[model samples]
Target chain A: MSDLQARGHEDWLDDVAVYALGAMPMQDAQRVRAHIAACEICRREYALLQPAVGALAESAEAFTPGNGPIVASPELKARIMRTVRPERPGAATVPQTDAPVRRSVAPRERPILWPVYLVAAACLAIALISSISDIMLSGQLKQSQAELAQLRSRTNALASALADRQAAISDVLAAGAKHYPVDNGEVVRSGSRLYIAMYDLAAPPRGHVYQAWTLPKGSKTMAPSLTFVPDAHGVAFVSLPAGAPETSAVAVSLEPEGGSKQPTTKPLIVVPLD
Target chain B: MTEDAVVLMERVRKRDADAFEALYDAYHRLAYGLAMRMLGDASTAEDVTQAVFVKVWSSPELFRTGNFGAWIARVTRNRALDVIRSRTVRAETDLPQALPESESVEDTAFARIDRELVRSALASLPDEQRRPIEMGFFEGVTHQEIARRTSTPLGTVKTRIRSGLRKLRAQLEMTVTT
Candidate 1:
């Protein structure tokens, strides 16, 4: 190694880590940024370690419904949808700018006629009434259309959710299905699909969730699976994302939101398939 | 699942409301959760969460490619950082850039592992190592500030951070491989 490389390993390596984390003070970080830009060894090390630092953001526990220090309210989603929905193409109304401009008649250019004024006033009254009636009908029509659209969206969502639940239920009852019972749940394997069905699960502590981990065959470390929150009825049925044939064991634990790479708490459930 | 997300994003680009909602339902927790952790207020967290998702809807094109979860997480963090900056008087320093566009095999593997795994890996670290790292990243404090809060020498803080990150990388690699 060159002298610069050797010295960097001794002097600047630690700074690279701090820099990667973006926790170095401004002046110190600037100096380190300059050095790493030139030093191949330190630069490579920074690149290697940066993802790990990025992964640190994932370490924060996420908010899960019913089991949270805080729940992300549904109103928040409504607020977001409210903001973006109007921005959708063809969703907003364009103001009419094509109405003809009327020129005022000069008293000298047009002879004053009382009967004509009276007729014009009558015409104006009829036009105003017609415009108001049209506006009221248009408003009702828009409101009805909006309600219908919302109903359609809800129906589609419900249909989709029902279909998914039905599929999971069918998989559980399929021939050759194997079931392993745990503390509050059962692991079901049907063909290549695996699922965890839990009942009467207490809500996780504030800012915590129940996360699953899979031990793939011949693997010592359990790979993290999905994080879930039981419904209001205290039930959850989650399909394992990976195939069951390759997984040897399944475990679940109460973890902070976002879950842990490893189980932080004792596994509440562990089932061995083989 | 990643492929599914890519497809969903394509739909989002097409102005599909259902597709956007699906993405939101899948990821809002991660976005809001990160915001809550950083901001420590439910109301502000909700606001930040809304802001992040709105940005996603407004500019799905900003995310050309890469891990959606990671990209969203970074966006949430950056948004929270702005709020945190507005709340404090600290000197502004540039945050680190997002993960490199062309990921190495290891980076791709790391991205494939979900947030829960990464959180578990962080949980596995010793408190001394984990605390400094958390303070630096989540709290957006500098090494000197971490040293002050944790009552360690600045040099020791830097060393601990390095040691902690290396250990974290090793743990994640093991998790990914296994």
Candidate 2:
């Protein structure tokens, strides 16, 4: 029997309830998540328990007249309406009732004229066709412009990457170049520029990236540098800002995507430059 | 006759202003109440409520399935949690990333029941059972934190929450059938 099966069904049931409530700690949650993925019994139990947890939100006492004095003011509704209907000026400024108040416009009576009706129909058709053509053309134009902008962005990124690669190569070859070996990587400093050259480093876990940090000399805290993912070969060359002259040490840690303001995990590699 | 929320949502996807207004009117109280309960401040609650509704208005597609009321409440709770996180260094809880699917007939029936009934059902639970669930649900605290606050063992707190939820589910199912 698998470890999950050995642990027994009743044992996992306790975790299913807490996991459904979203109250489990990250480590415990991960274990429960893995078990739930493998165990059909636990999955059903989780699904069964979810609605009850969801129903708990309804237990909150909403504000009503005589319930309390903490009612949501009309202004709050007005603000929401304004944001949703910005195109229609003053249309939603007034708070609405439970039912949306619709304005009904009455049709006026007029004498029937066959020729006038025919002429009007023809004019409407012509106008509609012209408007549709214009709209189609406008849409295509916008698409083209967007494509152009995207291409320009890609080119600029490529140019920047090429420049950095060239600079890194020059840094390594330049006189007075200093290198400090780290775990599967090294920190290279030439003049004021610093670069982290990593090789054979495994990809960070999903939803995570390798972030570099610099601890400036005499500073207790490490300032954030940049976040990067290695290429297909598990190789990365990242350039740090020109703060290496006064920097005491550099460190890299696996952080969530978009990076964290501070190190949230232990450093995979730390290089002391000072 | 009152329109179904799904029908109103379809109209909302087409930018039917009246339908949008009706949806807002129907669920605003729930959203505001949830935010207030979690946040404990009237002005901030109103802000959170407005943000939640505006999200529904702009991206109704984010709510793919499940009870609309339940989905909105989850959104409001998550927003309130974000506000709380901004203010303190509380350990973050992992709320579900995807929208919940309405899985069974019982889930649908429970969704249709009155909110007041759910409230009363919760109120009927013993304090030991109910308090931990509330602390975990509203406060977004971990089970460990709940244990710490109540001075109970971690295992006991988990058991009480599990027992309470099971009982709550039974009561709601009974109410729906009757």
Which stretches of candidate 1 lie above 4 Å from their native place? A1-5, A26-37, A63-70, A87-274, B92-106, B112-116
- Model 2 interface DockQ: 0.27
Per-prediction interface RMSD in Å: 8.5, 8.0
Predictions' DockQ, in order: 0.21, 0.27
The candidate that wins on DockQ is 2
lDDT of the candidates, in the order given: 0.76, 0.76
